[model samples]
Structures are given as C-alpha cells and as structure tokens.
Target: MFGWHVPAPDQAMLISGGKSRGEAGLPFRIVTGHGAFVVPVMRRVTYLTLSLMESVIEEACVTQQGIGLAVKGVIAFKVGSDQASIAAAAQRFLADQDRMSVLTGQIFAGHLRSIVGSMTVEDIIRERQKLAEQVLEASKLEMANLGLVVDSLQIQSIDDRGSGYINSLAAPHQAAIQQAAKIAQAQADQAAAEAQQASAQKQSEFARATAVKQAEYQSEIDQAQATAQQSGPLAEAKAQQAVLEEQAKVAAKNAELREAELVAEVVKPAQAEAERIRLLAQADADRTKLSAQASAAEGRIALDQAIIAQLPQMMQAAADGLANANLTILNGTDGLNDAVAQLAAQGSTILQTVMQGLAAHHDVGQQGGAGDRTDPPALGPGPDDDAAR
Candidate 1:
C-alpha cells in the first residue's frame, strides 16, 4: 500500500519509470476515473488536475480605425479529459501545473489584441460577441496544443482612453431613444389618468344609483310596515261591523217575534173576546124580541077572556033594571025588540073600550118592567084580574 495512490474525480494520475526516471515504459500508466492504483518503487506518480477555470485578459490595442482601445475579456477553459489531451498536458506541465492559467491568459490576450486590431472601435464595443468569437477562433489551435479547451470567450469591456469619440458617436441615437421613451411614458401616463377618471366617474354613478335604489326600497318597506300596522284595527273594524250587523238582525228578529207574540197573546184574544161579546149581544137582542112577542100574544088572549066574562054580567044587570022601571012597550012588538037590540049593541061597545084600556095598561107595565130589569120577568097575573073576579 506504500505505492498505492488514488486520484480525485477531476484528476489524472500518471505513473512513470519502471527502470528509468522521467521515461515512458511498461510500468508507466495514466490513471483516471477516480480509483486506486499501484505505483512501483523507484517510479514517480504525477497527478494532473482537470477542472474548469477562467482567465482574464486586458490589452491596449489599436483598432482598424487607428483608435487605441483597451479590450478586457474573460476566457473559460479547462484541461481536456481525453487520453491524448492528458498526455500532451502532462508532458508540458508535469512539474508546473499552476502556470496553465497564466499561459492561457497570455495567449487569449495576444489573440484579443489581434482581433481588436482587425476591427473598428465601434465593432469592439458594440459587437463584443463578434470580437469574442473571433478571438476564440484564433486562440483555439493554440489552446488545443496545450491540452486546454476554451469553453467560451467574452469581451467584458472596451475603453477609449478618455477620448469622447465613442460618446460623440452615440449622441444622436441616444437622444432619439430618450425622446421616444419620453413620448411612450407620457402616453402611458395619459392613458392611466384617463382610466382613473373613468373609474371615478363609474364609481360615482354606481353609488348614486345604489343610494336611489336603497331609498326607494326603504320607502316601500315603510309603506309595507304602515299597512301591516293598520291591518289589526281594520280587521277589528270589519269584525265589529259584522257583529253589529248580526245584532241588528237579531234585534229585527226580536221585534218581529214581539209583534207576532202581541198578535197571538193580545190582539187575537181581544178579537175573540170582542166577537164573543158581539155574539152575546146579538143573542140577547133576539131573546128580547121573542119575549116581547110572546108577552104581546098572552096579553091579547087575557083581554079577550076578560071581555067575554064582563059581557054576561052586564046583560043580567040591564034585564033587572028594565023589569023594575014600568011598561015600556009602547008600540008593542016592534018597539020592544028595537030597545033590547040597542042595549045589546051598547054592551058590546063598552066591552071593546075596557079591552083597549086593559091592553094599554099591560103594554105600560111591560115597558116599566123591562126598563127596571136586566133580565126578562116571568109572566104572572094581569092588573084587571081582581076587578074581573
């Protein structure tokens, strides 16, 4: 393990001298790809680092326009990883690996000068990529010979050494660009201002419309609330009206019932009573008339009987008186018969007068009795009865 050595990933290890020093032989080998290897005694091992690095080149060179321009640039390079590139780099930088960046910088500087000499100052400043590309192309073979790969070349800066030629050359275009930028900025500001004004106007209009709508809605809400507030009373009024109407109907019904009851209880009974009284009065009148007629017939029969009884008594009396007086038949048969007949006629006339007087007295008594009595009197004896007996 004393002769065993390992190389880093970015390194190539070279083994030399199996029998001779600083020589390539059977024992000499290049080790890469990061692993351990054997190094025999009396052999040398050299490790070459393969890593990316940069070099800076600053050179004052005269342009094709005869202007002294200082060109500053950077070159990114690395040691090549191929066997041939490693072998070539190992031969050149075997003992001095730190000299690679210095030599690369010098080489890029010489090429940068050559490239700047070929182009104008404007080309070196404005077309820095063209300058870098041309420099890269010129330095390519030289870097490859030294086992280096140039990854990129960039021109960092170009100076005109305080001469105002570059500024003078750029003045017109810079002024034009500044004018165009100012115009663009003014236009943008105008557009922004107009947009802000429009936005403000729109917001104001929206606010006004919203306020109006809210006012209208509030008014409607108030009206609805008022209507709701009045609804209870209105309903109560309607209910009261209905109640009153029902009461009126009941009262009317009561009045009708009362009228009907009066007709039944008072008017009908009174009418019946009046009809009964009229019937009784009519019956009494009829009874009175019949009783009067019966009394009149009875009186007539009594008078006739009285007159017949008195006629017999009077005839006997007259016969007695004539026998006591004297001979009264002067002319015998004819005169005597005429005197008797005259007496008989005079008796008949006096009987008629007495019957008339009795009839008148009976009528007067009947009238006096009727005037004194509420009921009809019963038929009894006549006034001429005592005289006739």
Candidate 2:
C-alpha cells in the first residue's frame, strides 16, 4: 500500500529518483495498466493523463487578398502511447497538466492565422474541410514534439470583421435559390389545381351515368308493370272464349242429336205410316175393281134369262098382227108365206125384249154397291108355261 503504484487505463505512472531503464532511456519509469512496487520515500511517483484533450483556437487572420478576418477552430490532441512520448509530456506539463490545453490552443492559433494568410476568403469558406485537414497535418509533426498527437481539427467559424466581403460573395447565390423556390412552388400549385379539376369532371360524368342507368331501369320496370297489369283481364277473356267455344260445341252436338232423334221418332214412323195407308188404299182399289167386274157379269146373265122369259109374249103379239092383216100365197105358196112371216115376227120381238131387259138390269146394278146387288131371280112361269101344263 505504501510503494505500490497503479496507473489507470488512460494514465501513465512516472516513478522518479531510483528507477531502472524502463525503455526509451528516460529519467523516470512509466507504468500503465499494471502496478509497480518501490522503496519507501526513495521513488517519487507522478501520474500523467493519457486521455484525449480539446483546445479552442480563436485568432484574427488575413486572407491572401489582405482582407482581415477572425477565425475560430478546435484541436483534439492526446499524449502518445509510447514511453518516450509519455516521458516528454511528463517533463513539460506534469506539474500543472491542465495547462496542456492552453499551450496547444496557442500553438494551433498561430498556425491557423498563417494558413488563413495563404488562402482567400472563398477558399476558407468553400474548402473549410480541406483547411482543417491541412492544419491537422501541419500540427502532426509539431504536436509530436510535445509527446502529443492530433486526432482532428475543425474550423468553427470565420468572420469578415464587418468588411462585407463574404456577403458580397454570397449575394448572387442566395437570390438564385429564392427564385428556384418560387418556381417549384408555382409548379406544385398548378399540378394540384389540375388534379382537383380532373376529379370534379370525373364526379360529374359519374353522376350523369348514374342518372341514365336509373332511367333505363325505371323504363324497364314500367313496361313490366304494364304487362303485369293487363295479364288478369287478358287471361279472363281467354278463359271465357274457351268456355264459349265449349258451349258452342256442345250446342252443335245437341242439334245433331236432335236431328237424329227426329229421324228416329218422327221420320221413320211417318214413312212407315204412309206406306201402310198407301197399301190399304191400293188393296181397296183392287177389291172395288173386282166387285164391279162381278156385278157386270151377273147383269148380263140376268138379261139373257129375261129375254127368254119375254119371247112368248112378243110371239102372241105377232100372231094377233097376222090375223088382223091380209097375207096371200099362190097355190101352197100363199100358206107358206103366212107361216114364214109369222116366224120372222116372232124372232124380231124376242131380240127387242132381250135388249130392254138387259138395260133394266144394268140400271138396277148401277143404283146399288156390289155388296147390295142381288142375283137375278130364277125363271118365273109365264102364259106359255100354263099352255104346256
């Protein structure tokens, strides 16, 4: 605990006044990352920081054009990791180590002014990164003398000292930027307006198309409705027509049946009846003709018998006439003549009587129907019959 010394990762322990050659042949022995033991009061130990350090440089500089400017920059430096660099850093800044930033800032400020004096305002502003790189490069050698290494240098700012040189240089670029911004804004506005107008036109066309489609649908619906409305009556009319047709057919069939009935009930019977009456009339006509022929024959027979019955009467009349009249015959001829005349008279009388009797019988027959006609009576006895008895 008394002589044991340890250094932090970022620290270097410098042990002086009785040390071995700890490399680089320095008067002190440096310990880092481990411990070293020493004799009591004989070795003096000092710790130097090996961590990074930052220094700010602010300097008044002149450009190559002789324009005066104020320049500000930062320098980042650290003690080197080697023993010789650590020993060198310890000899210079180990008593008051925070003064490392002050010395490094002073050194970087002088170098920054000198570098700015070699360049113009345009190079300092436009090539600020290159300026910082060059300045860091230049300080690499100089910082290595103090056992330090520069990690980076940044130019914080440069002022024109109110000379208006930087403003004059940048005026044209600022105005061009403003003009470009305005042009971009105008193009964007035009594009937005065109898009809005196109949207409005599309909406209008959609509305019109919707209206047309609705109208077409409505028309179709109306036509369908009309057809539906008429269907009831049309169906009824058709039904009634069908009914009427059926009725007519039935009526026509009834008429045909009635005609057949008339033929069966009336025409057939009427024809049969007419034929019966005609047959009876024909039979009666034939019977009446036969009766008339029989009656005529009976009349002729009665006339013949009546003529024979009247012959004797007519001869008596003739004999009377002979007695009353004169008749002569010479010799026997006179007698013969009388007798012959008498016979001739007798024959003529008989003929005349036959004709008269026949006429009388015909008259009687004509007065009665054949059913009422009587046969002639048998022959009656006459005066001649009495003479014969």
What value of lDDT does candidate 1 attain over all alpha carbons? 0.79
Model 1 misplaced stretches (Cα beyond 4 Å) = 19-28, 34-41, 229-389
Per-residue accuracy of model 2 over 1-389 as CA lDDT, tens digit each: 97777889999998888646566677878889999897778878789999999998889999999999999988889999988789889989999899989999988887788888999999999999988887777777778889998888889899999999998888877778778888888888888888888888889988999999999999999988998889889989999999999999999999999999999999999999999999999999888867776777776776677657766765665555556556565669777777867568656765766467656766666556566555554433455643432
For 61-160, candidate 1 gives per-residue lDDT tens digits of: 8889988887788888888988777877888886898788899999988888887888887766778888788888998999899999999987788888
TM-score of each: 0.53, 0.55
- Worst lDDT run of 10 residues, candidate 1, spans 372-381
Alpha-carbon local distance difference test for all models = 0.79, 0.82
TM-score of candidate 2 against the unseen true structure: 0.55
TM-score of 1: 0.53
